[model samples]
Target: MDLKLSERYEDYREAVRVFLEEHRSVWRQPMADSDGRPSAAGRSWQALLIEHGYTCRTIPKQYGGHGGKADILESFIAAEEFHRVGAPTGLANQGISMFVPTLLECGTPEQKERWIRPTISGEIVWCQGYSEPGAGSDLANLQTRAVEDGEDFVVNGQKIWTSSAHFSDMMFVLVRTEPEAPKHHGISYLILSMDTPGIEVRPLKTMTGRAEFNEVFFTDVRLPKTQIVGERGAGWQVANTTLKHERGMLGDPGQANAMLGRVVAIMEEETLDGVRLIEHSGLQDRLLRLQARAQAMKLHGLRLLTHGLKGEDAGVARLIVKLNGTILNHEIAAFAIDVLGELGALYEDSPHLKDRGFWQTTHMFSLGLIIGGGTSQIQKNIISERGLGMPREPKPASKGA
Candidate 1:
């Protein structure tokens, strides 16, 4: 685990910094959809990232990517650079973050050829069809079914909390293909096009006044046999690969650090008791703690990346980092709101505001971090069982049993 970047990597870092600086003004606009939906500007930004070899940094050069080592340190640097200049990281969602990695690991060469390049190029957007009304954290109980029909599978059922489904062109779905087998063993993963006739996307509005998530209905939506990623009935295993990717995306410490920097800047611009808000000891103490946590999380991320590069299991560590990261984000958001006092209530673009009303929006958006990816409770269960080696929780008894 060398922390030292090679001369080449240092050069790469400097190049990325210069690109971001040149585009800083373009990236400064706040994304339109605060519910984590990608905006038109977001899509354009993603294309710029791909052209500059930032998106899919980990994909091999042979596969139409930059062929970097999938290094977490590099990801950290990239995230920090983007956040420092108020730029959104291209395609920071379950699709690019989770599904792309799964496809690379288990997909056929044809599938990769069909999907990966387009995804990286921002020509196609993707969503996850994992959670159903009944299945969320108990994802093994997912009811979306994909019945085999000749050279294609006919999918029917519904997916809930599908972020970006409305704007996405494709979705990576987990479907129940073998009803008679046990819950976890009877599933399969499929890639389905959103334009398929039977697919319906209805946006779900949240407290943030944004339609960021959607309820996706599949009524006989059909996918070609070639769309299946891994073997049928091995969806649970395939999902593990996706979750590992999710953990990495969610636990990214660079995002927290970026938010911390924004808070510091806001505090400097603000005043209280005839002095700057940043000079307040209470606020300073809290910011210091957040900075320390961000550093620790970064180091932990490095360890996970080193192990992952060596093909080692990092599931437990991923969960631990995600659990800690979300909590830290919530705390930082809370402090920002408190420090802003009455001014925190102002929305973006409001009259006579500080930092263009970003603090208020950030405070509102922070809660989603805890709930999305996987809930805090779900992360705790993983940590308890895998990290502590605790006994599995007892399953509820069936009515007939």
Candidate 2:
């Protein structure tokens, strides 16, 4: 979608471009620790973004964000430009994309004051603690426990598939605060310091041969009750706020543009049977379709952003964004793999190959995009029950019946 950039966004766009140009030297593929934020080098990259006015634009003035009347579309545009130049803006880190928005909506004055600045500045890193060994897609069924003790909530539970937990200084964890309360009811959202005694972060290797995820175990890790974001036992609701942001970020069209650009780059230069890959009518049609979808998703995102600027709900498009975006991502990367044939499949062994075999890395990482933020299956269910207002499937009757 061609953006109608008025004077309002023109300066901002130029500023972002300049930032990318100046900092190009520090650029590499932003390393993700787990939840897809910059890890190690990513921290330095993000700290610089915050230093410039490129990030934290929506944060209110009082809470130490760039505070102003910036529209959400600005962030999207910046993302596009960043990806185009291969810069790591860190604007889309789960911390910025998911958690900050949640805080803006529900955080208390003190809570926002205490956490927002440091988080935005990259002084503290965060890992999500929602998915458990048992709770992967069925998140509310989480079994981690947090018992109340005076002013503290003593936590004991295990969270698996936690990204960057080993490298983070803090975690936003969901724990069952009221054991007797219904499964969904007793959960609470709390910020826990990773340094707290009895908290263990152990790396869990992925099929990709990298360990950006971890299984975090907590035994009696105590957090002040004041650390809770919403009211006690309201964690389920609080978590939904984060998820909504997450799904939106995941399904964003700007991301599709990045992937599509990579595919086009490969298609133009690659060959099959001595014929340029892009010269193939069939491959050309596929690229056109992916481009169209990227445009559609991009335009849809702008529509949502327009509504947001008008203080309207981002509208029905919100529901399908994650599902559609993630699937297209997988397809685009898969197409590149098919075109490159063996070279795309090479990893560290073929350091001389294109993207240092990062195409293969991206192919594997694509599945995480599908699985994280909510699996594609769960997303379909949301589109059905929530978007189309379809009746939910009936649950099985208990034996007592």
Q: State TM-scores per candidate.
A: 0.82, 0.85
Q: Could you say which candidate leads in TM-score?
A: 2
Candidate 1 lowest-lDDT run of ten: 243-252
Query: What lDDT tens digits, residue by residue, belong to model 1 across residues 90-150?
Result: 7666667787789889988888777787676556778888899999878899998988899
Global lDDT of each candidate: 0.78, 0.77
Error of 2 at 282 (Å): 4.7
| TM-score, model 1 to reference | 0.82
Which residue runs of candidate 1 sit more than 4 Å off their true CA positions?
1-9, 18-53, 68-83, 86-88, 149-152, 244-254, 273-275, 279-318, 348-350, 398-401
> For candidate 2, lDDT tens digit of each residue in 347-377?
7776657877777887888888898878999
- Judge candidate 1 at residue 262 and give its lDDT: 77
Q: Compared to the true structure, candidate 2 yields what TM-score? A: 0.85
